[model samples]
Every structure is written in structure tokens, then in C-alpha cells.
Target chain A: MSTVKITEEQLQLVEKLGLVFEGPGLQPAAARVAALLVVSDTLELTFDDIREILNLSKSATSNAINLLLNVHRIEYITKPGDRKRYFRSNLARWKNVMKEKFMDLEKTNSVLKEVVDQRTPATKEFNQSLEEMVSLMRFMNQQIPRLFKEWEKSKS
Target chain B: MSTVKITEEQLQLVEKLGLVFEGPGLQPAAARVAALLVVSDTLELTFDDIREILNLSKSATSNAINLLLNVHRIEYITKPGDRKRYFRSNLARWKNVMKEKFMDLEKTNSVLKEVVDQRTPATKEFNQSLEEMVSLMRFMNQQIPRLFKEWEKSKS
Candidate 1:
């Protein structure tokens, strides 16, 4: 009923990559589903295909798919005349992920600045270092846009 | 017996920061401990001070402290003639944390390259985009060292 064949090696890669996503707070099932989509041979996979391939429970598969879809980590399309939805990894938004990380750094810098402002002069050295840390973060946050531009320029 | 004091604002900041650290897989009590040391008035905190301030159980405080110490996220100092240990946030190692994150990006890129290599031609479009993602990652990985170097030069 299906043409998808996953090698043991591919299965191992899926778990390894899944752990990488899980490092950033993604749930285990959703992470595994995302990795499976990325490394699978088929361009797109239906819900049952994903569930069966990963040996996940029906609810687990549905929940994982929903979460991934909500986050835009994975996307789906419905084929002409087919009622089932096909899900696939959406690697195109990789730039947005990096930008969001940079934004988080900026937010952290502001928070630390407020912390620094609230500190006593007795913590002068630590405050100075923390300020420096914020400066460095600001510098890195600025670099992401430039880096993306460079990547884009090289592509064209 | 204690000179340290925490404001309502600082306490809120600690919880906010605990959530930030938790995003990267740090434990709750440990994250709170690390944030507490950063925003607290005192440079270093005793075990009892930490446990009381954060309202953590003895075992929770001990486990969190041990984990932060083991990871070098926090460090301890012992004053002469004092039997108690004084723990503080090791913000100086923040540079190393950023470096480790970049290293992680490099690791993920390599694993993704392997994914692209093993993928069938039917998924060519996704494969090429994945390759571009890897290339962009490699570029960013190279940028981190240069960013730090630029930062150091500016400092001196």
C-alpha cells in the first residue's frame, strides 16, 4: 500500500537529529516527526505513513503533526481529489529561525541591562562584565542580518 | 548574619531568566539559581541563602547547585577562615557558551549533510535547500570566531 522504505541507518539519523531539535525545547514526538520528514526518501508523507514509519500511536502522530504544523517546522498540502493531507519538512524558513534566535539575544541583553542598572556599586566588577556581555550579544545579534545578506548575495 | 537583599523586581527577573535558561534544556531549580546569583545584591551566596531565597527544598537546592557547578555555569569560592562555600553566577564563561552553541550548529549541519547525501533524487528540491541550509550554517559557524576576535580587539 506504500512505497516508502527506511533504512536502519536513516532511522538512527532521525533519532540523532530529533535529539538536536529536542535540545531547543521541542517535544520528543514532534522532533522525531520533523526529522523523519527531513530524511525520508519520499518528498511528502501522509499521516498514516508517518505514524506507521515511526511506529507511533495514532494520537501521538496527530499531536506531533499538529505541533510541527503550528510552529511551521513542517507544512502540509492536500493533493487534488485526495482527502488526506501530506506533510513535509519546511527547510525554507531556516533563516527565520536564526533571526528569532538573534531577537531572543537582544531581548536578553535588555533584561541584563536592567539587572545591571539595579545592582549595587559593590558588584562593580560583575556589573562591568555583565555589561560587556550585553555589548557582545548586541554585536552578535547585529551580525545575523549581515550574515544572512552575505549568504543571499553568494547565492545570487 | 546576612548582608544580601533581593528586591521584588530582581525576584521577577530571576523567574523570567529561569524560563530563558530552561528553553535551552537547563533544569528549573538550577536555572533559577543561576539567575538569582546574577541579579542578587551580593556577589556570592551561601547554600542556605540560595535555598531560602528561592524557596527550594534542601535536595533540590543541593542538586541544582551541583549541576550548575558541574557545568561551570556557576562557580564557588571559600573565604579564608570561613567553612561555608560561596556560589556566584559565572557570567565570564558566557563567551564559551556562545562558542559551544556555534559548535552545536556545526554538528547539526554535518548530520544534515549526511541526510542530504542519503536522500533520493526524487527529493532533489528539498535536498538542495537542505544543502543551502548547511552552507549557511557553515558560514555562521566561521563567523563566531571572527565575532569573538573583533569583540576582544574592541575590548583592548
Candidate 2:
């Protein structure tokens, strides 16, 4: 067992991020688990350790952690010589989440573009507006990978 | 009054986007209103016109429209010789929405960096993880305006 203590401010930040994570379709408990993991002293915690700190029931903790793991937002590894599993935030996978979102945006943009293309030239103004949106989304998709590359360069 | 018709597919898209808008702090009615405006043939509709199409109560329409207007997600224009106001989606302002979200992400990154700094050197691995998130968000903030500019050029 690790001697980690969470401060009041840390707990408050965790609750706030818990809500932020909840915005992306995570359940309330799962979001809280993600938040707690992010704010934990070592940024990695065992199942029993998290449950004890969060005062969560075993079932609640299990369910929330499982959801997080399935989403690839969090991951676990077994410590050598120990039977316990340690979980931590999968920060590297956030780029994948951003890519997935932009892909969805691209899909929506294409659908909108198709809708615009089928319209008569008489609907010029509205078609132009829709076209602008498609252009914007396309620009974003083109640039996101470069942004990811920039981050990699910054780290090195 | 404009001769505008929404097709079944268009209406479905509007409904989907309405739910997406609802997730971003807009009330359900406001989100639906925003979605309808986006898919409208004229891209602009009068208050009475929208109320009729959406089958909303007068007060509900008023309340929802007011909320959207206050948030700068929608805007209205007055026609010459007309007392009636026409509302439309402020499509250009969506860039601002994306900017605001990135700013919030930057703030969260800063807070995490601060937390990482306070931890002991022994938590080097965890601090490095948090630093990478900060770097990624920082990179995004630097690139978003450039992306917006690229969209402008593409449109031209």
C-alpha cells in the first residue's frame, strides 16, 4: 500500500475535471475515476487504493474502471512480483480521440457538402454558406496531424 | 416570409446537431432552435416563423431565443420597413467557440502542470506525463488561429 494523501484543492480539481470528462459521454462515476487518477499523487493507483480514497463500493469502482479501460482513456499494468494491477491515465491516446472527433467532423462536412451540391444554383447564398462550413472542417482535418507532430517535436 | 422547405434527411441532420448543441450548455429548446436555423433554406427565420415551424409555445421560443442570442450563438437582423426581427445562425462565430474551448483546455493544462511541479522529484514519470499534456495543449493553442487563417485563404 502507498502512503498517498489527497488535499482538498486536489479533490476539488478532480471533481471539476470529472464533470469535464462527463461531457465526452463518460458516466459520472467513470469520469470521477478518471479525474481521481489524474490528480492522484503518483498518477497511478491500485484498484483497492482508489476505492479506499474515493470511498467507492467495490462494484462501483470495478464498473467505472472497466468503462474507462474499454474506452482506452485509462490503462493498467501488473507490477512485477505483485498480484495487484496499477492503473494510470493513458495520456498518449488523447491524440487518437482528437483524430476520431475530426474524422466525424469530416464525415458530417462531406454529408453537408453533398446536400449543398444537389441544390439549384438559385440557392447560391445558402450553398455558399454550407460550402464555407465544409471548407473550415476540411482545413481543421488537414492541420490536426501537423499539430500532433508539433507536440512530438516539442517533447524531443 | 420566404419559401423554404426542409427535406426529411435535412431534418434528421438538424435533429442530430440539435442534440450535439445541447451538450454544449444550450438548453434543449435553444439547441433545437440553433439546429433549425442552421438547416433553414434562407438561413434566417423570423421569431413567429420559427415558433410556428417548431410548434413551440410563445414563451418557450422567446426564452430559448434569448438564451442563444445572449450566448452569441445566434443573431438577429431587422429588415427595412419591417418591425419583425429575423434570427439566423452566427456561423462565423463558431471559430470563437472553438477558440474558447481550446483556451479552457490550455487552462486545464496549466493547472495540471502546476500540480506536477509541486510533486516530489521521485514522481518524475508522472510529472513527465503531465508535461506532455501541457505541451500538446500549448501546441494546439498556437496552431488554431493559423488553421482559421488557412480556412479563410481556402475560401478566397
Candidate 3:
């Protein structure tokens, strides 16, 4: 078993981020996964090493790791001669994630606009309000690609 | 009373966004506020107009409006003959709100990093992982100003 000890202070910090350590849901496990990723960014621990240190069952650990990966919050790297896959968080991929999230929000906003359009309002004012939100979100969505492009340029 | 008939589809859309039509938490209030902003943007509804439609007590609606204002999720405007404040969601302003949320996330990530740094046996791999998250968040934060500038330029 790995002898790495998690401190109370560390746990507190993790908890502040809405991560539960010993909670009744996937939240705690998720938080631990995030904490592990944060630590792993500065350490050289493999999956086995991390699982042992956290004292989590293999299945629980794997579930957490899988969730992070699906969100693009964590990534796996394979080292030659080491069959074990090493997991790490990519610090530069959030831009894409944010972009994706914004796009999804825009899509939802569009659907809402259609609903608003179909609803006849006794209040002309209320109808107008819904239309404006649709316009605003659409405008923002239209601007995203340009925003990302400029972001890419500055990074280069 | 503004007879704005919210369609079932529209209600579903709002619910999906976590806007509460019926709930015990601030969530419903928050959702009402958000919906109000959406309406105000297009309909130019005055504060009194919003209160009547949502069926919320004036003070309750006022408080919810204030919360949205503080978050930059909505803005209030005053017009001639309109002693009452008019509220609307500023689409352009949402970029700032999103930026602030990203900064908050970065702060949380940093705190997590500090905790990992103080943990015993300080596995190099774990530390590396934390650093990676911090770096990723940092990069994302850094990209914001440039992205906004580009967005502004493109809009012109």
C-alpha cells in the first residue's frame, strides 16, 4: 500500500470545491478523483499507485477516473514497458470544454426561443422578453468561433 | 395582469436549465428571476410588470432581481415616466459572468494544489497532476481577455 497521507487541511481545500470525501453519492468519489488529478500533476504516481494511496476499491477508483476522462478533465498516458496507464489532467484543454459547454447552452436557448415563438402572450411585453433572450444567446453563439480563433492566436 | 401564456415546451426548456417553476429552494426564485430577465430583454417589462406575472411578492421579486444584478446576469434600466426599474439580461454582459465563474474555478483549483503540496510523502506524480490542473486553469483564464478582445473586434 502506498504510504502517502492526505492531510486535514488538504481535505478541507478539496471540500471547498464541492467535493465530498465520504459522502453518500458519486460526489465524494468524484472529488477524490479530482484531488488525485491535482496531486498527480505534480507527482509521478501510476493508476495503481493512486488507487492504493486513496484506499479506494479498484471499481470505485476506475469509475471516478472514467468520469473525469469523459469530461476531458483527466487523460491517460501510456509509458513503454509499463502496461499500466498513467492518468493526468491536461491543463490546456479547458478552452475546448468551455466552448463545448457554451455551444450546448446556445442550442438549448434556441429550442426555448422556438417555444416562446409559438406561445401567444396576453402581455406583449413578456413575448418580447423571451425573444430578446433568444437573440442574445444566438448572438453570443455566433461570436464563439471568432473568440476561440483569437484565443488560439494569442496562445501561439 | 399580462396574460403571457408560457407553453409546456417553454416550461420544459426552462426546467432543463434548472429554472424552478415549483421548488422549495432559491432555485425557483432564481429561475423566476432568470425567466423574468429573458422576458424583460425582449418585452421591455418594468419591475412591477414582472412581479405581477411571476405572482411573486414585490419584495421577493425585488430580492431575486438584486441577486441577478449582483451576478451581472441581468441589468436594470430607468426610463422617462417609469419610476420603476426595468430589468433585462445583457447578452454582452454574460461574457463577463462566464469569465468570473472561470476565475472562481481557477481559485478552487489553486487551493486544491496547495493542499496537495502539503500532503505527506508528496508523491511527485500527485503533485505533478495538481500542477497540471492549475496550469490548465491558468491557461484558460489567461485566454479570456484575448478572446473577448477578438470578439469585440469581430462584432465591430
Candidate 4:
């Protein structure tokens, strides 16, 4: 049995950090699980460890775990000797998550451009604004790669 | 009565753009309303016009419009001699909405910093990654203003 005791401070940290993830579209329970994984001293927690620590019901924990795993936010590894699966936050993947979001914007921008194209020239002012918005999204998408490159350079 | 006839293409535009807004946390109905306001040739819609065109229930349309207004995604204008207020997309404010979203991260980061401070030194590797994530967010926040400035210069 893994010998990790849940701390009150750690539990509070889960709740605090949980709300942050929730705002970005994560389910509340899943966000809390994500927070627990990221901020815990152990860095990895078994299924029961998370459920007991967070006081989540079996189904809630199961659903939350599945959701996180499916989203690539959390990942699991099996122990060499035991059949138990240990779950850990894919903290390293956060930057990739943000990048994927911008990549998703390309499809949306394409549709926005299409909307702009089909609109009657009578709505010239509105079309100009929409065009500006699309250009801004494109500008930011272009900037993200450069920005991350800048971050990597500065970090080294 | 204003003479804005609903078209099939416009309905599809709403569905397409609605999904885009839904991704970033807007409710489906509200997202549809936002899409309609932005893409429609008229640039604005009356409450009844929106309700009829979208086939949304009275309450659904009302709730959707209210949500958009509360978020500053849409605004109302009154004609000089008419009492009926006209609803229009505040498309220009979309960039501001994205900016406010990042601005919200400042508060989230403060709590994250606290989590880092309270963690045991033993979790050095995990702590380092969390610190990096925090620094990245801070870097992006700092970069956004300069990025926007560069966009303005390029636009002109």
C-alpha cells in the first residue's frame, strides 16, 4: 500500500487551483482531480489515493479520472511488479494544450473568412470589423510560435 | 417593421460560428445569437427577429441575449425616434474579451505561487515545472501588449 497521507493544506490547494482549471472549460470534479495531481507532494497518486484525498465518490472519481485521461491532461503508468495504475499530471503538456487551442483557431478563422466573403457589400462596416477580428486571430496565431521561441531562448 | 428576411445560408453560418464560440465557454444558444449578430447582413437584430429567425423560444432568446449583454459580447442601440432598442454584435470587443481572459490568469497565478511556496523542497522537479508554467503565463501576459502594438503598426 502506498503510504501517503492527505494534508489539509494540499486539499485546500486542490480547491484553489481547481477553480482555475474550471474557468477554462474543465468539469469541476475533473479540475479538482487535476489540481490534486499537480500540487500534491507525491506527484503521482493511485485511484484510491485521489478519491480518499478528495473525498470523491467512486463514480465521480472514476468519471473525473477518465475525463482527464481522455483529454491528455493526466496520464497513467502501471507499476513493474503490481497491476496498479498510477496517475500523474501531464504538467509538461500544458504548453502543448495552449498551442493546440491556437491551432484549432485556423478552422474557425477559415469559416469567419468565408462569412466575410459571402456577406453583401452593403454591410461594409460590419465586414471590416469581422475582417479585423480575423486578422487579429491570425496575427496572434503567428505570434504564439515566436513568443514560445522567445521564452525558450530566455529560459536557456 | 424592419425588412430583414432570414435566409438558409445565414442559419448555417450561425450553426458554424456558434460552435466556435461554444468552444471558448459561451452557452450554445448565446453563441448562436452572437454568431447571428456578427454574420448577418443587417449587423443587428430585434429580439423578435432573433427569436423568429433562430426558432428559439422566448425564454431561450431572452436568456441568450441577456448572457451576451452581461459579457459585453453584444450591445443595444436606440434609433432617434424609435423606442425599440436594436441589438448588435460588439465584435470590436472580441479582442478585449480575450485580453480580459488572460488578465484573469493574474489572480490564478497568485494562488499558484502560494502553492509553490508551501510545497516541500523535496518535490524539486515538480516545483521547477510549476514555476516554469507560472513564468510562461507571466511572459505571455507581458508579451500581449507589445504584440498588440506590433499588430497595430502592421495594420496601419
**B40 in model 2: Cα distance from truth in Å?**
1.9
How many clashes in each candidate?
A: 0, 0, 31, 0
DockQ class, candidate 4: medium
Write the number of the candidate with greater lDDT, choosing between 2 and 3: 2
Supply candidate 4's per-residue lDDT for A84. 73
Alpha-carbon local distance difference test for all models: 0.86, 0.77, 0.59, 0.86
Best by DockQ: 4
Tens digit of per-residue lDDT, candidate 1, span A70-124? 8888899899999999998888877788678657777777877777888888977
DockQ of each model vs. true complex: 0.75, 0.38, 0.12, 0.76
Candidate 3 achieves a global lDDT of 0.59
Model 2 residue runs over 4 Å out of place are: A1-4, A79-84, A118-120, B1-5, B80-83
How does candidate 4 score on lDDT? Answer: 0.86
Candidates in order, interface RMSD in Å: 1.4, 2.7, 6.0, 1.6
Candidate 4, which segments miss by more than 4 Å at Cα?
Answer: none
* Per-residue C-alpha lDDT of model 4 across residues B50-100, encoded as one tens digit per residue: 988888998999999999999999999988987777999997788898677
Q: What is the TM-score of chain A alone in each candidate?
A: 0.94, 0.85, 0.75, 0.90
lDDT of 1 by residue, B1-156 (tens): 455678888899899878777766688999999899998888789999998899989999999999999989999999999999999888889889877866888777888888888888886777789888888888888877888898899889
